[model samples]
Target: MRRALTWVVMVAVGIFAAVGLWSAAVDPAPVSAEETAREVSQSLRCPTCAGESIADSSAMLSDAMRQTVDQQVRQGRSADEIRAWFAERYGDQVLLAPPRSGYGWVLWVAPLALVGAAAVVVLLVGGTSTRRRWWAALLVLAVTSLAGVWLLVPQTTPDPQRLKQEDPPQVNAVAVLRDAVDHAPGNAGLRIAFAGALEEVGQDAEAVEAYAAATRLRPLDSDVRYRHAFALVRSDDPGAAREVLEESLHVRQDHAPSLLLLGALVHGEDPDRASALLQQFVQLAPEHPAVDQVTAFLAGQLDEVPAEALP
Candidate 1:
């Protein structure tokens, strides 16, 4: 019986080690926009909605928040950077995920420590053979259950409401951009710069307007048109985006960025055309940073290529 129990423990340990090794060896699937948005939102509270995560809320503000998360994720920002962006705008209260510092560490550590201590105490206690068997069984069950839960369950930190708060320092990029735009109102370059700053700050609608202005000032510039179309897509006007991208292609037939963006915009509604455009883009810009993602996407390995990977 003792040998049998030892073998059972060894099997469990081997299974756990194999799982750990497999997880370490396998590359995580690229995160899709919706999944990335949902994951970020799960860590954030809806600023305009009460008692709900941004992921769970349908309020317009929550929608904007989700878009910001999606944009940041596509831009390859880390989760901490995205959280910091929200915290800058809405205070630390915007985060549902508790900081891992201070007392927060205790909440995570104490439970597992208690389980370990309990098991140790059970093994150390002097008892009858039946009692020893019972204790051993309980210990095994407890350890197995806890290990399963730790591996399978997504662990959320304690509620942010209960933790101490610190406000993030703010940078008023919009005001700086506005000042620069005012100084050179006719400069298409300045306007594009302003638009990019606005997009970074989660002001998608304003970014679209700024991009439109830049495109108007440089109507013959295919690059400006591509930027405008990309901004339009981010603002959820894919039809208009398509028209602008087509105009860009008319201006410069080999404009790789426009082709790539257009492909992504139409990927859902017209996959054949999208695939052709993406293939053309790959041929035109083989050395571009987005090529790997596009290749992965074309090969059915990824759901979508991130926007930041584009020029």
Candidate 2:
């Protein structure tokens, strides 16, 4: 028994060494292309994180975003075009810096103006009586504090009615999407958009319903199905999420998002299936931001990772 155990260990070590050698032989991605991808990624916030740039985040969504950036960069897309694509997918908040044209100039210039104004007030009051100088200081402090609060503190809940009344609710706000769905109830795309808007507003249950309706309208669309699965997961319906993801995989076996999500959902209950799916995910998306996360998870769970899944 001891000799057999020793032989098995030897074989495993040999296999791993061979796999390592093969993985090392493969060339890495181009350095310039990676640097360009990083530049664009740094400009975009991770959709699933608070103020975290996608380039600097470890979340799976950020990984996917980075992968998109890398692919667009490799395709020779211009920086503005890449940014525009991200904005369309995730909205303008994805861009760290707001546009400077139009009234947006107010957002950029107001703080500087407030500071400069306060400085001038202080200079003017420098030679005044102590009481008068103190009054001027108080006034300046109040104005600066209010300006800071206005620019820094995000509103907890946006007024949907006010946004709805705006000429262009940027097309994806809850009220506008709700109106869009009302006007075109049968449109699968509209349903998906409304569902996304609902998701953004913490209406996960309603989002699930909308996503379900979208899947009913476009049954073979793997994208819609996977998105529905995501909503179901967010709604705390893991069983249904698994079902929807499996259905999506049935439609398109190589769908990476579906594979990644389903693998995570089933990781504890059906580890073998999860491992297979995760292996496929890594195979399909080797450059994903969460590759390290997935790799670490896999190493922790398994006694020995398969050679193909190693690098």
Candidate 3:
């Protein structure tokens, strides 16, 4: 029996060793602290999400902002200067992730506090057996180690999307929208304008949220709804676009633009059904652009007829 127990222990040790090796092989090598900090900050919207910085956005404007960051970094600009550049352009709104001051301190402290509380709880539970307490201590140690590692790790990689959310190195139209959002938190028009700016610059995700907020504030406005749906489509989130289009249709039937988009979407997925919708579209507006092209395309599927029968 002793020999059998010894064999089981050996097997367990071998399994653990293999797992450790596998994990090491699969885990990526640690990045520089600076790169890690950059990635974490990137893609994080400014507090309102409408005031997204280049680091937090994937827009064309954000791309330009990122290029500026790279140029500045290469030119030996200080971290403070780089951050200040964005702060100057978009004001405080361009910061991706909150600044590490004021309310921002809360974000940094919450995780650490949770871990510390857990460790304290484990220590206070003295009624547990010695072996159980040891295991608890080990768990707390692992958590503490991970927290420490997170603190030490630098953000190194720069995300272009985050450039929009991060402070811009310069002032521009997006800055205007940011200012507007700051002054009028409850204004739907201001939100929509910011969303458009985001889309114009290629920050689709932030634009999506901004558009959503605009629509929520003015659900009766088809213009806002259409823009919201269009933004969703631009972001390549067709599922959301379709749903919004349907909602818009429910509110106002025979909306030609919505019909056109839905018809295209439906047709892309199922040609036969789309063809029927195209016919309906023709009946609704014969002189619409691309009408002849669509009709000719549909004609290919029908039985051939002589020119004399043509409309």
Output the number of the lDDT-best candidate.
1
> What would the TM-scores of all predictions be?
0.43, 0.43, 0.41
Worst 10 residues of 2 by lDDT: 163-172
- Evaluate residue 134 in candidate 2 and report its C-alpha lDDT on the 0 to 100 scale: 56
Over 220-251, each residue of candidate 3 has an lDDT whose tens digit, in order, gives 87777878887887788888888998898788
**Model 1 C-alpha lDDT per residue in residues 1-311, reported as the tens digit of each score:** 67757866876677677656655456343367666667778888765455567687775445555655766787788777887776665566666754444555675556667877887777788387667676766677557655754564444644545432433223344653565465456867768877987898889999999999999999999999998888888888989999999999998989999999998888888888989999999999999889999988999997776777767
TM-score result, candidate 2: 0.43
Q: What local distance difference test score does each model get? A: 0.73, 0.69, 0.62
User: Model 3: number of clashes?
Assistant: 42
**Which is superior by TM-score, 1 or 2?**
2
Most TM-score-accurate candidate: 2
Where in model 3 is the C-alpha error above 4 Å? Answer: 1-171, 301-311
Q: Write the per-residue lDDT of candidate 2 for residues 109-213, one digit (tens) a residue.
A: 777687767767676766656654554555555554544444444222224344334342122356545644654568787788778778888999999999999
